[model samples]
Target chain A: MARIIQCVPNFSEGRNKEIIEKIVEEVRIMEEVKLLDYSMDKDHNRTVVTFIGEPEKVILAAFNACKVASELIDMKNHTGEHPRMGATDVIPIIPISDVTMDECVQLSKELGERIGKELNIPVFLYEKSAQTSLRENLADVRRGQYEGMAEKLKDEMWKPDFGPANLNERAGVTAVGARMPLVAFNVNLGTDDINVAKNIAKGVRASSGGFKYCKALGIEIKERNIVQVSMNMVDYTKTPLYRVFDVIEREAKRYGVNVVGSEVVGLLPMAALIDVADYYLRLESFDHSQILEKRMFE
Target chain B: MARIIQCVPNFSEGRNKEIIEKIVEEVRIMEEVKLLDYSMDKDHNRTVVTFIGEPEKVILAAFNACKVASELIDMKNHTGEHPRMGATDVIPIIPISDVTMDECVQLSKELGERIGKELNIPVFLYEKSAQTSLRENLADVRRGQYEGMAEKLKDEMWKPDFGPANLNERAGVTAVGARMPLVAFNVNLGTDDINVAKNIAKGVRASSGGFKYCKALGIEIKERNIVQVSMNMVDYTKTPLYRVFDVIEREAKRYGVNVVGSEVVGLLPMAALIDVADYYLRLESFDHSQILEKRMFE
Candidate 1:
């Protein structure tokens, strides 16, 4: 099987279309890499580029793209609604096919070191690639953003995992890490009662006593007259989608509210959906290998 | 989007590894064509080669592989447990991505004409490419196999759809057609009672007035002491997998039997499984576009 990895790097400049285009163009030049998506948010002043390919090809494409972003984006002048600490910001490597999470972590560490040494940008490892537990959550490392990084660097505990403690006025610092595929799944309820949705969200999210890897928020789709329990399944393998849906269904039944429909916000691995089918359909022991198309990959 | 089509051709020369390898070698030479799978059955004396690519590239590879099969295989000395009609017995082109069934029908007709004109072997179009309703079912056209095909060729009703009416004593005749992706889905019963399995099959198959596109049969695995309801989902879009499993579950309940597990025999399109997930999860208006990986194709 071919080892496939995906990289989605968020850069701090979204309003400047020229710079975003220039940075994305670098990824398009790689023959083996497939550019999946690139979107700019003016409010956040961030551009997120998604691409996937063989591990090596993805790494090279990501390296080149980040290099261009670092050179063009000036964090000192950057202002956005979304949190940020660097020009390139956060580059996350996700294992898509035969590649494992451990391998992705290793790749992220190697890339983080190279960026620190070659690009002279301070690098902090977050998520699976973090060297310390304090640095695991990206929000923690980027708490003060670029402006406060200079003062934070004076403390040994706040020093970056890579490069000099001194902050780069232009590029700032970058977060490089590896993580499992995250699925953005949402369920809409039939009732217009936003409280019902909020209660359900409270009962099903990690912050409460719900699924461990699930982060959920209830929002009212006023136009549609429905309450939605939007969710981010950070670890689909451990929690699985069916369990979440079933729990919500059970929870909604308490208030006589029914689930109208569910939605998957973004791309998910085939394995994630197959598990749902297996459970709901009562398929005793279903495996992806049974699918003929997967046979081609084998 | 790129148009993608899959072709699986069964040739009658499995025991001879050299001949099988030579024939498969032709398919491997085509650029942009993916040779997904090729397997030989010694007892059946047959080899099924699966491949996919652009329509033109698939056709080129199919033709080249057929030419090699015809050269090495002789009908006079052939014997197999499975049915056989020619050196290259059957070729079915299936639309995989960004392609329609109507387009596949056109491609099948064009390929049929070329095979007859260039190879001089009798060809009959079955399934979606069948000119007449009676010829649509492959079993009807391939009846009596190779030995009886020569005599059947004399009948006006049995005239070849393409090529000479006369059969090649060695190559016999070939069946070419277009069809939807066939999903071989099997559900295992909890009990060891074979009759219970047989009864469940009758209640869930098209011929038995179950699901329209489902073809089901009951089989016993003597060694495992288990019975299975083997099914072929002819058109998954019309008769989705979740519906079929549910119907079987309902019917099995009558016989005091429960579904142990289900097995997907071969490859299935990712969309098919996603449909099951959406339906079972009560997902409203879900689109594959939401998948981040799908953006790679864009």
Candidate 2:
């Protein structure tokens, strides 16, 4: 089986179409890399570009995109609701198939070093690629956003993992890491009362004492005239999609509301869906090897 | 996306290990062709080889295997539990992914014509590749088997779709067709009471006015100490695996017997399992395109 890794890089510039296109073009131009999706959130002023390929090709494509981001984006002048640290905010490599997390972590570190040395960007390895336990969480590594970053770097523990011990004035710093594939899923409700959606979201998200890896929010989709429970399943392997959906459905019924429909916003790992299949079918000894298309991928 | 077609060719030789190996080797060595499985049923004296690849490669590999089967086995001397017509009895091309049934039908015709013209084998196109309404069923095409094929072919309605109107005494006749992916699935019952299994099988099979595309049987698995409702889901898209399993489960409950477990005998299309997920999760607006591994397969 071929080693497949996915790279999702978030860039600071979202509203500027031309800049966003230029940054995304790096991934598109890479021979083996597939630019699965790239979307700009004007409100957040951030763009997330998702792509996948062999580890080497993916790292190269990601590095090229980071270089483009560094050249075009100015972190000092950037403003967004989401947390930020650099022109290219964060680049996480996720092992998609036949690739071990250790290998992806190694790839992430190498990619981080290359970006730091060649592009002269300050790098911090977070998540699975973090060198210290204290840096394991991305939020901890990125605690001080761009403006606060210059002062935070002066601390002994906050020394940059690579490149200069200081942040680049214009390009700023970047967080490079390895992570599990996250599924962005949303389910619409029949009720216009956003409280039901909010209550359900709170009951299903990780922080609110629910599923371990689910992060959720209640949002009003005015155009649809309905409320939605938007979620990011951080680790679908642990907290299954079906369980979360089932809870939301059950919670909706308590408020005398029915689930209108549900949708996955972006690509999701196939194994997550296969888990649901195994659960419902009560299949004994079912394997992905039974999937003809899976062998074709290898 | 690459167009994938699966070809499962059945040979009349099974007990002869050397001969079965030679026949399957043709597909094993073909470039871009994946020989997923090849098994010999000694009781039936038949060998079935399953392989998949691009349409052209699969057809070429299947044709090569058929050539090997024709040269090694003589139909008149062949004796087996299973019905037979030729050394290579039947070849069915099934669309796996990114390929349509119409395209598979076209491929089947091309393969049938090539086999007829090159090997001097009388080819009857059955199922979706049938030239007439009367030829659409495989059992109808091979009604007489090898013993009576010579006289059957002489009749106007029984004229072969390709090759000479007369059957070759040594090789007999071959049935070629395009078909949907078939899942060889069996569900075991907690009770060894064969009658309960038999009755449940009748209620779950098409012949007994159950699911439209399901063919089923009840058999005792002596070694396993249980009875099984064995099924061949002819068209998973038309008659999904989960729906049939639900029926069998419900039927088994009526007999006060529980479903012990279920298994898929060989490779199955991924979409078949995904359909189960969609049903149980009650996922709306779900698309196969959202599957990351599916994109990798393409």
Candidate 3:
């Protein structure tokens, strides 16, 4: 079986169509890699490129795309609504199929080494690929962003895992790591009770002793007159979708609130959805191997 | 997005490894084609080769593999535990990604015509690609198998959708069609009573007024001392997995039987599983677009 891996790199230049096209063109040139999508957020001033292929091909494509982004983007003059630390802010490698997390961690390390050696940019490993406990959280590693990196790098604890200890004025620093597929799911409540939404979010997030893998926040969409329980499912396999949604439903019911609808922000593995179906359908024991498409992989 | 299609061709010479390898070798050479799996059942004397790729590439691979099978195998001497119709028994074209059933129907028809013209073998189009309503069911079309084909070909209704009106003694006849992804799912019952399994099958299959797209039968696995409810899910989208399994569970309760477990026999589209998950999880209006992997395609 071919080991398929996915790499999604976030570059700090989303407003320029010409630059985005050029960066994406590098990935398009690779015959083996399938470029899935690329989008830029003007307000955030960031561009995210999504692609999947064999592990080696994906890594090579990421390296090439990053190189192009570094050349065109100048972090010294970069400003955005979102936090940033580099021209190519963060590059995450996700294992899609027939590949393990450990392998992804190893791939991240290899890419980080190459970026440091070739581009002279600082590289920090986060999540599963982190070298130290402090660097495991991306937000922690990118605490000061680019502006504070010069003084921050002086501390031994803040030293990057790869590249020079000093900062690059043009490219800044990049965080590369491997992590489980995260599901950005949001549920809208029927009522405009922002407090109800906030309480539900607090009751269902990891920080508040809720579902272990869930990180949630409540946001009020003023125009829609609805409150949203926005969430990031970090480890779907462990908590699964059914469990999370059921808990949220139960919590909302206590507040006399009804869930109007839900949304998934991105792509999900087939297995995650099957598990939800199995539980809801009350299937005694359902294995995904029974699905016809899975047989094609056999 | 690339239009992905899958073709599974069942060929008649499973007992001979050399012939099976040579037949599959044709598809293996295609650069875009991914040969998912090939398994030979010695008792049935048949081999099922599963592969997927770009629509045109899959069609080409299927044509080449069938050509190889026709040259090496003679239907006159073929014997198997399972039903046989020709050197290549059945070739079903299934829509995988960014493709529609109508498009697959057109592709199947074109491919069937080419096989008839090029291979000089009678080709019957069944299921979605069938020209006539009577020919939609494969079993009805292949009533007598290879042994009965020569006589059956004489009738107007039995005339193939492609190739000559007469049968070829060597290759016999081939069944070609376009259809939805068929999931071979089986649920084992806790009891040894085959009647219970049969009753449950009747309650969950289309033939017996169950799910509209479900076809089910009861089989006894004597060695395991368990009765099985074997099912072919013709349209997972119309009749999702959770709905069908729930119906079976409800019906099984009437017979005082419990479903021991369920097994998925082959590859399944990720969407099918996701629907089940969404339903059970009560994730109102869940969309696969939220999956990170899917974002690559967008």
Candidate 4:
């Protein structure tokens, strides 16, 4: 079985269309990689590029994109509403199929070493690839952003995981790690009762001690006169969308609100939907491998 | 988007492994066609081969397999528990994605014409591709099986939609048509009472005035000491597995029987599972195209 992995690399410069296209083109031209999506947010001044393929090919595509970003984007003059870290802000590698986080963590470290050694840029390992518990969270690793990174790295506890301890002013710092894919899903209610949405969100999100992998919020869709319980299911395998949606539907009944519908905001691993089918259809001995398209890939 | 269609061709003579492999290999080597599954039932003396690809490629592959089966399997020596009418008993073309039943019917007719013209094999169109309402059902088309087919063909009302009016003795007659993918699913009950299973089966099957596309029967599993409602969800799109299961769950409750479990036997189109997810999750604007594996093909 091939080691399929997904790489979503965030770059700091989103305002420049040419630069974003150039970086994205690197992934598109890779022989085995499929360029799933790439979006630029002018407000955040950041671009997110998503692609997937075999581990070697995916890592190659990710490295090429990082190289392009380092050449074109200068963090010294970069400005964005989102967190700032590197020209290639953060590259997170996720295991899609026939691969594990342990393999991804090893891949991430090797990728970090290559970027640090070859590109001569500082790199930090966060999430599953973190060397210490303190560096496990991305926010903690990117605490001071690009400006304070030079001073922050001078401290013993904050030493760079790979590459030079001193910051590379032009390329800035990059954080690479292994993590599970996240699903951005939202369920909309018929009524505009924001309290109903907020209450349901409170019951399902991790902050309030709900599903460990769930992060939810209440948002108003003003034009539609409806409220939505938007969520980020960090690990769908652990917290399936159907389970959470059913809970929200039952909870909405409590507030006299009916769940009208829901949306899967972006591309999701096929296994997530397969799990939903198994739950709803009460399928026995069902496997994702049984899907025809999946068999074609094999 | 790719015009994906599934072809399931049933052939006579399942006892010979070499002949079955030879026939199945015709579909295997076709460009762009995926040989999903092929199984032989010695008791039925039949080999059912399943494959999928674009409409044109699929038809071509089906033609090649039919030609091979016609050469290898002699209907004169064929014997099975299942009904049979030809060397290639039946060829069903089903729309999987970005294709319609109308398009599949057209493909079936075109393929039928070619097979009858080139292979010199008699062809009858049934189901969606049938020329008359009387020939709409496959059982109606294969009324007398192989032995009685020759005499039946002489009747004016029983003329085949394509091919010669007389049957070919060695090659026999074939029924080809366009139909939706069928899912052989079964729901088991905890109790051993056969009556409960039969009543629930009647409440949910098409013959009993339930779902229009579902055909079901209650069968006993002696070893397990349980009864099951086995079903053929012929058109999963029109009457999905989840809806039928829910009805069965409710009906089972009335009899104080719980739906212990369910099983999806054989290959089912990926859309069937996607529909289950859409219904259970109450997704808004959810499309099967959103699946990552589907996009890879596109």
Candidate 5:
């Protein structure tokens, strides 16, 4: 089976329809890569594009899109609610199937180099592709945004991983990295009691010393008359959805509440759900080859 | 999304490798169709080929393979342990994704008619595509093996659904139909007592007033020193695997036996596993669109 990877890139100038279309066209024209989704946030002034394919094709699509962004988007005139650093702000390569983090890391570096050398956009390899611990966190690497990027790059520790050590006036700088696929999962409580949901969230979140890869919070669904423990499952392969769900159920029971239902906010890899079934059904010696649809690739 | 369907066809003269290859090559040559598997049993003197693709492509592949079988396989000279009726013995069309049973039934009829008129092979539309209640069961349609089929066709009740009432001299006759995808699932018991497994199998089988789409039996696994309730879940959309699993787990507790684990013996539709996860997790408002890989079709 071919290794599949997903690339989600955020680019500046989402408010300009013509410019966003021009950048997105690069990815759309690639027959080998599927453009899963692309949405422009007017407030944030950024367009997030999601696409997946074989590793090589996905990287090519990301590179082509970034090149278009560099030529079309001028970060010097960019302003939005969200922080910015370049025309193509950030590109994160996520392993979807038959792929590993190390492979994704290498892919990110290759993409970064192409965008930097060919497109002339300075690239910072953050997250799993980071060369230094400080740069591992995207927030730290993107701290100064576009305005402060030129001055920050002058510092010896803040040198760009690829391209010129200085920033580009028009395209600014790009953050390219590898990361685990994130799943937005929310479990609802039977009752409207906010406290029950809050406690459950605290018990399953990493910040509160719960599941190491979970980031969770309590939220109210006023229309449904229920409270939910919403979570960002950063690494389901390590901290599976079923484990967190079982914990939340037990935690909610203490508050005299039952789990109403759970929701997966957006698209998630099939492996994430397969893990849940494997745990609950006690499926033994099951593998991807046993999935009838997986035979399509062959 | 394209409507995908699976076709499994069995043919006579499995002992001849050249003949089997000629038949399978027709399907393998179809660029749009994927041949999932094909195996020949020397003892049974039969070969079963599995393939899937969009409805039209799958039907075309099946036709091409059957055409090759009709030309090369002489059923008069065939002898097999397994029951036989024609060179291309049987063709079962199964809905896999973005498809309904009604659509599959129609596709089977279309394929059957083509085989009858174009190949001059008498066709019996059994199972879901059966024109009469008596023909609904494949066993009834194939009551007489190839040797007895010519005499059986003389009866008005056994008249072919398509083609001349008389069987083709070389090809004999074929049974083409639509049916639900079958999943082979088995639940293992902790104890070695075979009776415990037998009782659980009886409680969850359709014949014993259990789930409507399930067929089950008990068997002892000598290697594991355990007994198992093996089942054929005929229609998971109606009789879900999780419900049958939960029932077996509960039933085992009465005999002081615990469910050690369960196994899915062969390839199963992804929806079967997805439904299991949805039920166990109490997932709400989930749809196939939320599955990342499903987006590939779009």
Candidate 6:
């Protein structure tokens, strides 16, 4: 099976149609890589581009898109609701198929090195690709934003992983890392009681001593007259969907409520859903290769 | 999205390794098409080759493989436990992705025409590709086998669909058609009593006035000390896996038996398992495109 990696890069500019298209065009032109999605948020003044392919092809596309973003998006005049550090704010490489986290870390370093030497953009390795715990979280890496980055770089502990310790005036700085795919999942309750949803979310969220990779919140779906335990599943490989769903089902039963429905807000890995089937059906010796469509990639 | 079709063609020779390799080589060489699987049952003296690709590419691979089978296999000297009527026994075209049954039927006809005209093999379009009710079933089309094919062809009702009325003495006749992918599923019961399994099987099998596309039988798993309701789900789209599973689960409950587990014998369409998730999870507004890997194909 070929090693597949997904790359999601957030660029600082989203309002200019011409600039957005030009930046996205770099990824669109890579024949081997698929441009799964690219959405521009005018409010945040940011665009998130999603694509996947073989590691080499994906890295090339990510680099090309970052190059385009750095050239056209000048940090001096940039303003947005979302926090920012550079034109291409962040690039995260996620291993999808027949790939390992270690390999993705190496890939992130390679990409960071390329952006540092070729594009002259300061790059900080974050998440799984970070050299220290201080840089592991994206919030800490972008703590100062683009404006304070130059002054923050003067600190001995705030040294960039690659490029000059000083910030690039036009591009600012970029954060490159390796991480798991995030799944936006929500489970609805039969009752409209918001407290039930809140209790369940509190019991299941990481901060409340639930599944470590799950970040959950209690929300209301007014149209449906129901409450929901919405979540961002950061690492499905470690904490599967079935386990979380089962917990929510049992939790809802305590309040004489049923799990009316669930929603996957955006795209999720096929393996995540297959794991649900395997659990519900009590499948024996089931391998991912047993999925017919998976054979095409192999 | 590209229209994808799966083609499984059975050839008369199996014991001869060189001959089997030569026939399968035709499909393996086509880079655009994926050779999913190929297995030889020496007892049946048959080799079933499975492959999938775009309609045109799949049709070309099927035709090329059929040509090799006809040239290498001679039905006059063929002998096996399984019944046969030609060198290339039968070709079933199955719609996989972004394709419909009607499109597959047309593809089968195109493949049949080419085989008949170029390879001098009489082709009988069976199943969905049949022109008359009498030829719709494969067993009916191959009733006389290779030995009686020539004599049977003499009758007005037995005329070839795409070739001369007389059958080829060496290669004999071939059956080509379109059909849905069959899933071999088995549901195991916690109880050892075979009657519990048998009753459930009878309740779900089509022959006993159950699901129209289901063929079921109760069997014993001696190793596991459990009884199972094994099934050949002929059309998953029409009779989904979840429906059959639900029926079996309910039936087993009547006999105070709990469902231990289930097994999918071989490769099944990814959609089949996804449907199970959608049903049990009560997924709302879930589209097949929402699958991340599926986007790679699109």
Q: TM-score of each candidate?
A: 0.93, 0.88, 0.85, 0.92, 0.98, 0.96
Cα error of candidate 5 at position A11, Å = 0.6
Superposed by TM-score, candidate 2 places the C-alpha of residue A236 at a distance from the truth, in angstroms, of: 1.0
Report the poorest 10 consecutive residues by lDDT, candidate 5 chain B: B289-298
Candidate 5 C-alpha error for residue A200, in Å: 1.2
Root mean square deviation (Cα) for candidate 6: 1.9
For all the predictions, what are the DockQ values? Answer: 0.58, 0.60, 0.45, 0.58, 0.77, 0.71
All candidates: TM-score of chain A: 0.92, 0.84, 0.86, 0.92, 0.97, 0.97
- List the candidate numbers ranked by TM-score, top first: 5, 6, 1, 4, 2, 3
In terms of lDDT, the poorest run of 10 residues in model 3 chain B is B289-298
Candidate 6 Cα misplacement greater than 4 A, ranges: none
Estimate candidate 4's alpha-carbon lDDT, on a 0 to 1 scale: 0.89
Which numbered prediction scores highest in DockQ against the true structure? 5
Please rank every candidate by DockQ, starting with the best: 5, 6, 2, 1, 4, 3
Candidate 4 C-alpha lDDT tens digits along B1-298: 2568989999997799999999999998998788988889999999899888878999999999999998998898888999999999999999987789999999999999998988888899999999889988998888799989889989999887777878888889999999998889999898999999999899899897999999999999899899999999999889998899999999999989898888888677778888888888888888777766555557
lDDT scores in order: 0.86, 0.89, 0.85, 0.89, 0.91, 0.91
List residue ranges in candidate 2 displaced over 4 A: A12-26, A29-31, A40-46, A67-83, A117-120, A168-171, A189-193, A219-227, A253-257, B13-25, B40-46, B68-81, B169-171, B188-196, B218-228, B252-261
Tens digits of lDDT, candidate 5, A89-110: 9999999877999999999999
By TM-score, who's the top model here?
Answer: 5
Greater-DockQ candidate between 1 and 4: 1
Give model 2's TM-score versus the native structure: 0.88
- Candidate that beats the other on TM-score, 2 or 3, i.e. the better one: 2
After superposition, candidate 5 runs with Cα above 4 Å error? none
**Native contact fraction of candidate 4?**
0.75
**Candidate 3 C-alpha error for residue B163, in Å:** 2.4
